[model samples]
Target chain A: MDKQYSEDSRQFVPETMSNMRFAVLVLGHGEMGRSMEHLLSGRHALTFWERNLEDGSENIPLEQAAAQKDFVIFALPALPHAELAERIQAHISDHCICLSIAKGMDEQGRTPAAVLGGVLGPAGRFGMIYGPMIAEEVRAGHPGFAELGTTQSDVYERTRELFAGAPLYLRHNTDVIGVSWAVILKNVYVPLLGAAEEAGLGDNARGFLATAALEEMARIIESRGGRRETAYSLAGLGDLVTTATSTGSHHRQVGRDLVHCAPGDTCGTGMNVHSEGIHSLNMVQRFGLLDLESFPLLRLVRDIVNEPRDVAAKFRPFLDASFADAASRNTRD
Target chain B: MDKQYSEDSRQFVPETMSNMRFAVLVLGHGEMGRSMEHLLSGRHALTFWERNLEDGSENIPLEQAAAQKDFVIFALPALPHAELAERIQAHISDHCICLSIAKGMDEQGRTPAAVLGGVLGPAGRFGMIYGPMIAEEVRAGHPGFAELGTTQSDVYERTRELFAGAPLYLRHNTDVIGVSWAVILKNVYVPLLGAAEEAGLGDNARGFLATAALEEMARIIESRGGRRETAYSLAGLGDLVTTATSTGSHHRQVGRDLVHCAPGDTCGTGMNVHSEGIHSLNMVQRFGLLDLESFPLLRLVRDIVNEPRDVAAKFRPFLDASFADAASRNTRD
Candidate 1:
């Protein structure tokens, strides 16, 4: 290398790392995954293991594509986040930085971070990008943005710098657990907010629901060992607001799922997504794990999800719960 | 007064102000304003003032509305709040408590709490109900809630306990400024998320935007003496989430404002409604007063709001931006 070139090279991490390629294995490729491929494509050598590929190679082993790459990203649903971590842990180099972008709580009503952390050990650099950057916007190269978070502030900066070259807008932070909690917990409420819209409630109703959801989620996350403000930041409050208001959020879709059925349908006509809140809500309620101030939204969400089908009529009363009594529920002793 | 009742009330308050007949007057009958009324209704000798009440005549004069309503609640837009305060000072009783439920940065982008505190004298009981209760839900007997704060914690508790009745929840804290700032600033970005959704973005995009808005709003609120954790709590986090996701949210309506040509036009041709973000976004771009992490969604909203009618094709490019490196606008630092 020339002297000036050598000096510059020493300063900048080369786009193409010699002997260390990146295997961008996107498990879901639903919407964000394909776009993740697009953003991560030029960073290093790229190969992917999309569960739902364009053709029908959903089951293709990661070895075929991820065999030589140094970095692997799990851009799938929470369902496979832990399992993927286990499989990836077997072959991934300790030096490799692994990132996950899924936003659902896991089977134990824990954030994907909790489970992912358990599976991946405490040493690997785990990074995540979350916020309002939709997959399509990212794929389209319109400066859609997200916050990059990780335990390793240096790694968070590194990952942010790595993906910063892409067309998408990336905000940097060092709160991977916060980001994980935000993405995971927000999943539960998004559907509920979406349903509220489909239920024909006005902005006031939607606003109230989303706000309460944040309160409840924050409380729950805090109880579960997450920072309260972390949830309040871009990860928690910001993401939830974006999702609840978005045109077609999965939670909104879930609300729609509950709406199309008869009023007697308990679980919104069973058309709802199988969300973590569906389980978390029930667990919280069953365990009476929280005070009245926390998790009211979660209780409602659980009631709507786990009950057989008559959730519509039960929830309808809430909508009609009398304007005179809809006083503010501030939750103080 | 019944001795037992007074004694019962004393349990919730300090001995100094237990006997004071708190005349709480609520200005504005919109969702938040009216929600205040709902909470304050049976609890105190509350009077309400709706700004555009074309027909109602049970209304009192502005002097009377401001006359000694122990708590003077300004539940209107940002522009009108300060004006209301100016007019309120004359009719204000010797020790009136001025509270606000409005969630907007003032003309100077100040939180309602600070402006109220500054205007009401340094010792005024100027606090606010900052939370995510939908006005409809609040009025409808659904659980609409908020947090109350004051430089005077005793005054905070006085207001807190006054409305601590059934169905009306109140969270108590001393972060009056933080809660107020969070409430107003979050509204700036809710609609921006709506536009992104209408533009056909996905969960990642919306999540990113929502989270970013929270972070920005929290910072703005914190800069003005509000707590970021409070923003994540019921008032800040809960309210924002509810507002953004609520189908009837003004913030969410920002999307419809831009997406539909007419208010009722659902064909996705053009939008109606002037989202606060469109206004705030322009302010952000024009003033550069915000950090790089401020509301991008708001910026997009402002862009569309200012766009000429003939450039519909240009707006449609959001969908294709990511695909074409069009989303990359920020200079890499």
Candidate 2:
């Protein structure tokens, strides 16, 4: 057997027979942080780092939490990761394994895992957990699939061992960069589906958006030095379907409200909503890492967000362009 | 430029500038057939063939319609396709192109297109139109994406030209076999999703099922001499999502009723329903063309349909085994 296969097969032990445990620290009290807390309840020793205590009790400091645990989960927003990683860098143990659940882009277009790594320096170990996981469902013990992306093979084994019986089934991978790009780009592309719904484009519209968006995402990921297939896995296609079609998605609501709001209305209900997608687009525009000419759908969404008027009218031309683009690709050998 | 692509690119004319029409014959005036009738309105000369009209009007005979049209569309179920194709073979015009929209398998596991080909003999030129088109939505003038899969590149060009400005946007491809398998296998895989919903499995369950099912589907398509990427296209993922999640799908209804029915009840509400998925599963079991070991989810669905008690209990072991399989694959590369 190959050396890598033997190491990987070792982590496949059934949960009932495995008794591995770890001291885990979660760095956020947000919805996802709480969900992770619920999932890890009895299987590990838990510690939390929150900025403020709601119950009028003092919380553990971030540095202290960073120093003690074998696993440190960063469930905070993507924006603060670099700062927090820097602050906790001196205190973190050499053996600590960092996992980021934030599926968002930084101002520099770096993923959460990248920001964490940038601050933690070359010695730090990190991984990203991403997929179709909704916080409420995870808290309720509903089954979901996720990918654990890390550069270090031993980190993958340790993370798998820790979540041996957890409801979140984590598949291991070394393509941390690919997972990061796919997860971030999925958020950026999902809003156009909502715009389709608001335009009364029907379910077929969702189908078109899914195929087209994923194809473009794979191309962009490939252009950026990540594997294209990563965009087809649980992190990209699975989460895009979940976020785009779910009536509860705030990002989707942004598109709906943008179209539904009257032309003169500047401040609609969705105007103030936190959309990581819009931020990601802005970062994409700034970075110019990908050729925007390749992605008609992403360009359309960006245009609509900038000027929310006559969505259906604007989208018609976009559709024509996209169909032409598809025809070109389809006939290519 | 390559000769094939030049012809395809010429067919890629924008809807605004294109004005091409053909005499179209639609076989079987079922819901989908009627929807095609509606979509083709004002764009072409139309003829319809139904066994018996509800109004008792004298409909055009099948043979006459076959001989008159430039395009002959068989929109009937897969089982009836062989008989219909054989009956019309001698009458169909030598210049006519055939398209099949039926997404079902015959008792011998032949797809609708395959059945049509088997009866039409070697000289017949054919294609398939498959995607997320729900009949009612098409009738209501909703836009939908579909692929025109044919080995003849000119046939693709001609078909695209005919539907240039129609609500049904057609993309061209030469992978007829791949599209046929993708469209057929999607019908077989969609019912399990319905079963998932009826079991009170949360939306995350849908996400997990979507990712896992498509992975297994691509493998099955590849094993059956079809391109695995076909499963990622509109014909597979697009149609599967539409069918599995649509409130009106009868196959989904079959799964829902099966789980909700009481024990010892051989005849549930869904017992009388004609599910293409159920028929496809039966055919698969008989043929044994693909290894059942590679598809745990498909096997679990087949098992539940055979005996519909305790969905979660039966599903747990399947998930465990799947995770183990995933772990093994992850370690290998």
Candidate 3:
């Protein structure tokens, strides 16, 4: 290996590796792509691929990059994952691991895990990285946490070595389905927090709404063949807190915008750009993936999004019904 | 029944009892006491007793106030609960329900539920109300959510009617022990959030800490004969989110103050008046209530509270260890 030069100094330094450094190809030139570069640039040989050729510089053929890399990180949005995975699957190395940071379902209501798994032919080479990793924070050098869901132990070990010194931390879980569903489902709960804030329901209501959402998420995950405990892990509760409470959260802004608009107003300011939350919400409903009647909070979020008129008044009745239902459930238990 | 007039009006109105109106005695005249008055004053016949006699007006004998009341709400701090419960236990009506909103253990590491149950003697009338009922928010007429934990069905029903028209909502749980421990244990997790913020750890760190704290809290609650589900309910996760994330939380401030102060500095600005989080930390440690080895987050909070030096550096290792332990545990499973 040749010595490398520091970007600022241009001074040659001896090549160093405490552990093996893999070739990592980051797919996308967006915020997450840049953040991944920040964490992985010094530690590994890195390459960047922009789907749209936005920069028109450092352009490499997708097949060439895919052929040489030891790992492909699908840092792009969920919409492009399936197509991209299919495009690169044939050229990629046999041992190459694919990890997705996408937290939304495609138009077909298939999660990124399903998309990648389908394209990768069940070799168990694909996994998901999901949790409270806000891209800007990772770029700013603050610690990030996530659950790495995969069936392969080698993938987990390679991932651990790939970003050992970076502030991002990972906990491995074998339940790819659970982590995928949890991270995706958490986005659906974000707008409700914004709605609660816009409605002036106060902190108590926020707390109540969060607990109710988690309960519903756990049930839905369980129904979909995922572990209930995964709903309480970093992929679920942790990501929900970060997205729901962060001032920069787009989904939360969607909720606030919904509250301000008049009845039947489909395009509030936040609705102009469809967020992952809105996409996930529509996908879940469109596919009839969950029984709406069983999940009151999820149902309430759907109702508020569809009609949005008198959104504030909708919360009280929903809360009352939730407590009453919980009371009855406890009675039976 | 007699006709009543609104507080602002001198005009009289016909007597109203959509349900039974009970005579209630509220102990303490602090912030919480006033907040409870705001909720209960209009609906029921109400009286108040102040332990410190901060206000000389409306003085009433303790026994006299306890004798005729159908409900006694202990709105004071945890320290005075046992003594007051004993003093009023004899004079209170046999059918009266004593519901405490205290969220800390007494000096002996006994929960408010245990103290009240010990004094009230097994007719199962004593109960607990706990969740995100911030006193200021309650006084402002925003809704509050709490779990009403009592073995008696009648106690649950009466307590429900007591706050039906008010903004406070209750879900009934039969585990007084679970609710009490959950509410108390939640305090132990608050200061760590403040510390995270002060350390510039960002939102991702905050999310991870919260999930970690909750995981530890559920384990501790279950180990102490309480239900694990209660830790994820309003009393545990709900209250934790409210207190940890709220700008006005004293415990969070304590964590921030600890980060600012030097090692061995016993009192920072936030530590001047020992918050309930600190008290609970001390009680749990002093009584050997939990095995510190099993709960790293709780132990980290205790260590930071005791030795305030280099507080910022503590979090990364703790997080790394936690995820590593979790990964190994998952492997074994």
Candidate 4:
């Protein structure tokens, strides 16, 4: 540690834990990655790399960047996560902190944690950052909240301390599996909120879906050995509500478009729109990690997204089926 | 059972268990009561009564209505529930089903269930109908969902059967205390969402608040011997999101207004608008049912509503304190 010059006060200060600057490597130059770079550049020794390297001056080789940093943030989409981790595997120090901000499933329906386990192996100190902090909002200095889910307590502490002076707020929990599933599944549920909006169900439907979605998510998480309460935390219920209601979200747009589009049709309004929820549904179905029978709402949303025609008609059967199940449960009890 | 005339077909049908109609007494003529009447009138023999007798023809004497009816639906505000229940208690049939649709704490912080117990004793069969069913939406024949919380299985079954052909969907649960507390406490948390919106915290804040509010409500409910999962159900999280985000909600409006109003101000823009959340806070403070120490968000919302001022300033401390607690917890773990 060395004396660091403060941009605000224009004076050198002796290094303290709060002001300790780490050599940080941020993967990708996307919106989220840039936002992280902006937030961390002034306080830390920051380096960035993008696959294409549009600006070659600031870019470094992936291996070089991975070997030199105290922290590696995966800001790329989940689809490329495993590949990227594998490419940089040999270069990453065992003690280097690895965190992911990705909130989607890979094509194989592997969560970021699972992908990391395959890529980084058990030797690396790793975790993830997931919650409701949108990149633009974070860039604007709006107060943001996130959860750090990792198996290692020291990893959580180091990650927590890394963002100590930033506008972001972080909470640490050891339920990595639970938090990972919550973040991954929220992408699958947000589009249903959009479908509810398209159906003119009003605020009441939004409220109903909000709770119902969390309960359904809880069942799926529990089936996978994740805690049910995690679905009620920032990573699950919080992120679901936020993403579902987000004004410019792609998944919500897909829902609105799916309502108007014919069966087996891509939305005419966008040239190549890819909804994360649609991708998630495909991956979840492909992997079959959890029983689909218990998740009526998820099945309904998946059906709607799959056919994307006469959404209301598609939804009614789901309501009938779920209520029928409830009625049977009532009788059994 | 005799042959019953079907309203839709105008033909007589042989009696079945499902078609057995109850003598239903509706206690209010408000939007909710009207909606219920619209839903149940065709299926059952319906009676109406109001203390003021705004409509003379339909209004029956309180004693007559109470004695003859097999079901008494309380659609009035929580403030009037106890007194109304008491006035009609002696005249009520021993086996009459008593149901409340009110979702607020009375002046003494007593939930409608507690008030019913105090007024009706153990003589009357009691339960509550609560969920995300907004009156206007239900009136429009929208699919609605609710939880019927009762002690008796027969009561739950009968209530479920009463709405068998209607758009209202019912689920039975034996956690009457938990469901009652969830519905009551939701009103107290809805304002926090409004406050978050007023602060321009974006969907992230909404997500953060949604999870935080439910967690706080769960703690309170659990402290009072109510089940924590009840807060995640239709009665709690569902209704809270609906009410908090509802465009026409007075409590949400109060939140936005409180942000702009001066200390000790009643939003000059509106005339004598009373918010249920404000009333709820006062009552909760009066009752001291749950420890307020764990509920910083509730306290911040209460303080803002009690004396509308710089809401952002008031909320920042709460954010700091909670994050500090989370960080310390992370380290301790």
Candidate 5:
């Protein structure tokens, strides 16, 4: 623990390391990209890239930026991960650690880890950054915590050193698949919380839903070759709590909108972007990734999303039935 | 799962049970007592006992109520639990089940379960109802979930029957000590969350604090002879989320109050109540139940509560040190 820095110390220089720096490439200058820039700009050499360039910004070519960078951050959403990973694969250096902050599935229902692993092959220096690292919070200079899932210890060490004194904190975990799935699937549970709030279900229901969601997430992660504890960790439970309860969360807004809109009405009007939660739910269901029947809460959320009418009506029965099932299971056990 | 009842069916008649009823004596006609009455009145014969008689209510003697009732609910706080348990012990029926909803320590720094177990001896039919069963939510006819911690299966069955088809749901667990400690100690975490929120720490900080709090809680519960998994269940993590995040939560108000007040100022003003969180913290510390050195988050919270000046200053260092410690431990592991 550093004793010299006070609580208001926005930046704490790591005493163990002096002037350690890395050349970083931040892919896609979105909210997260800008936040990443805010955290890393003073400490590291940073280059930004975006498909659609904003005015007064330098648009660096993908190959040139990837070739020289020690770290490449895929700060974009999951949709473009496959294409971008393939584009940068050949040019990136052997030691360059690729990390992603994406928290949703691609068009093909694959996680960012899967896309990176598939594109970069067996020995790719790729990892994931997932947990309660809310972009706006990071940009505001408040500390953000996350799990860095990578197979290589060197990758973890380098990643740690990169953000040593910054507000972003990382804990190393080798369960890449588990961390990836936990973070991706958590988005699906966000709207359910928002819907509960909208229907005046109160804090008790929120707690129930959050707990139930984590249980279901653990099960889902295990079914997908991931560890169950990973779901209960920062990547799943921690991130879910943040996104589900945060007033500014877009996925929560989608749920609030579902309660007010007509049955057939398109939710998230004027937002223009599809919610990652709804998209993930659709992708998971369409791909038959897991047996939704076993997960009553997830099934309920899916049902409500499919037919955006009488959300409170749909939610109540689900709660009763789920509790009944849990009680019966407890008896049997 | 019952399909016959719609969501608006505030009262679902349990299909399995055929008009089974119990005489329920509710002690303390406060918020929780009224909520219990709202859930159990129509199905069961009800009696209410308050320390002081309200306007038109009949004041049944404690002995008389204890002698006749099938179930006695101590809806009071922990302060009076020991005295009341001893007072009604000899008069209560052999088959009567005594349940408490208290979530704090008594003046002696003992849990309600401890007090009841001490006064009523090993043969006493006592249990705890703890989780996200907020009183206002129950009164509103929204579903609330809880864990019924008891030794006997029959006690659980009867309790389940008591709340069957009602909005209040229960899952039986035999670990009374675990559930009691988890729920009781959760109050202490609430103010930390409130402090974080009050200091303009973003949702990311809330997520980190919640996860850290739960981790420390599990450790504390285990040290106190409870199972670690019990702290992760509904009674611990679930209830913590509800109280910490809820707008109407009194403990959260304490944390928020700590931020605005001067050093050593009386917090939770106008509310006219000492927070259960602070009381629990004081009791736990004064008793030296657990080594505070091992739990950084709890220690930080205690320090902030003791000296409520420059709260943000105190909080940020704690977060950095905790995360740094976690990161270093991860490296060693």
Candidate 6:
């Protein structure tokens, strides 16, 4: 641990690597993207690779990003996740480990790491950075932390060393699959909690949701071939708690909006972020169609969130259904 | 589907065989055990195996519970989970199916199903029921859904059928190991949420906690031989949401009290109704032994809830710590 680590340094410049200049190619410059810049500010040598709004450049041209950096972080949205990876595929260097901040599954439901695996080939070294560390917190020097997952143990160690002097706590995991899925699917649970709270549910409701939500996340991550416990670690559940509990959560905004809206008002795009939850809830239902276990609450959330309704009323029918005979089914075993 | 299944008449009993009326013997009259009765009443021939306060005689001793009934549900605490199964094993009939309503892992950190399978030899079929449906819900005619997991799909179906017309939504799964773990371990997430809520977090905070909690649950269940996607199902996330969201949730009650008092202070005695969550959380820590994936927040809960002030201070650092770091972990390759 560096003596400087305890001190408030917006960016920690590794004295050991002062001569080593690395381009901090940030794919997306949302609050998270900006936070990454702040974390990497004086820590390493960095060059810019953002699709500058003023410059009116198309999404940060991969060719330019490739030439400028020693490392790359793909911090884009889920929809643009694959496209960005595909664009940056050839540009990622063999030695330069790629880090993904975008927490979502691709169109194929593959995580950012999986997409990168396809883009970077068999030997691709990938590192996943996830947690509740928002850009605003990082900028404010409010000591925060994150989880880093990598197939190679050394990659984690190196990333730890790189950020050794920073305030964020970095943890390790072998199951990037679990961590990635957690980072993505966890978003779905958040909206529901928000809706529950908006609907006047109490602390007990939050507690139950917390446990139930993790159960659901474990199933999703495991389906994607990640370690189940990884979701419980800082990477998955821990980070989600921080984000979902904070003021800046996009899901919270959506939930507040859901407070007044009627069912089926999902078409409006006025919310701060794309309701990735809508997609995940659909994915959960798709699982049901595939003869998978029924995630009824998830279906309820998707339905209620997209189609604004009597939140409590819409949510209650299922909750009110019979415990014995109310269990639904039409699936062929 | 018997036509008589929907009626109040006793004349038309199904003639799959002679009138061999089998009872759904509940071997533990705690919340889950009692809850099972409400769901099974008017549907299955019901009886309970708990110590009758009036005469102090259980209908059938735990030792004889397995052999006498067609279906036996063991809804005991984790401490005696293995012992209950062992007792059931001693009394189990050759063709009886043993189901556990206990949603927690055994002493070896194995699912109750796996533990039961080993203890019961080849004489009995072991299965698990997991989800958010509480005994109160079943008693109130509310939908009480749960996942019944077993090795054979037929067992799942049969168990689901046994709960027929009882106002319970039943789901069947092949991952008994996963289902049991998901159901049991989720209890750990509750107090953690309660603690966070106690600490004065808002909707976003709850949202973050919910997602992270489920992610953590998924990882924990998967590590213990359960499926990941199961976490996404009703057994996993759905149950967590319900438990975390309601005052009806016994676990959160402990948490709410813990913020100001002790668990014993709130629930007069384990006698009125069972608080499986209290025991489940303890069992989780005992069985998990440092299995960070299962209950990272539980340690804090136990300390804050059970420990002295100064000792609890160590746990406090984490409360203020960035959840991103707390949820994520050891990212070394």
**lDDT per residue as tens, model 3, B136-252:** 766666677888889887788778878756767788888778888888878878888888788667788788888988888888888989888888899989998888877777767
lDDT sort, best first: 5, 3, 2, 4, 6, 1
Alpha carbon deviation, residue A71, candidate 5 (Å): 0.6
- Give the TM-scores of the predictions, in the order they appear: 0.65, 0.91, 0.92, 0.90, 0.92, 0.59
Could you say which candidate leads in lDDT?
Answer: 5
DockQ-derived CAPRI band for the predicted complex in model 6: incorrect
DockQ metric for all predictions: 0.21, 0.34, 0.44, 0.41, 0.49, 0.13
Quote the lDDT for A44 in model 1: 60
Q: Which ranges of candidate 6 are over 4 A from the true structure?
A: A1-30, A33-100, A104-128, A134-158, A172-248, A252-260, A263-333, B1-34, B41-100, B103-127, B136-142, B149-155, B173-248, B253-306, B310-333
Residue B78, model 5, lDDT: 92
Chain B TM, cand. 4: 0.88
Best by DockQ: 5
Query: What lDDT score goes with residue B24 in model 3?
Result: 90
Clashing pairs in 2: none
Backbone clashes under 3 angstroms, per model: 89, 0, 0, 0, 0, 88
lDDT for each candidate structure:
0.57, 0.76, 0.80, 0.75, 0.80, 0.60
Tell me the tens digit of each residue's lDDT in model 1 across A1-333: 245333322222212222323445555555657877766675565665766545755566864455455567777766667777777677766666777777655555555666667877777677776766656445544444556666665555456455645544544555566567666668777777766656544344465566556655666667866676666655666566655655545555666676555545556334434654455444344555456444456556666665534443444444323221222222222
What DockQ does candidate 5 have relative to the true complex? 0.49
Judging by lDDT, tell me the better candidate of 1 and 6: 6
Q: By summed lDDT, which 10 consecutive residues of candidate 4 chain A come out lowest?
A: A5-14
Worst 10 residues of 1 chain A by lDDT: A8-17
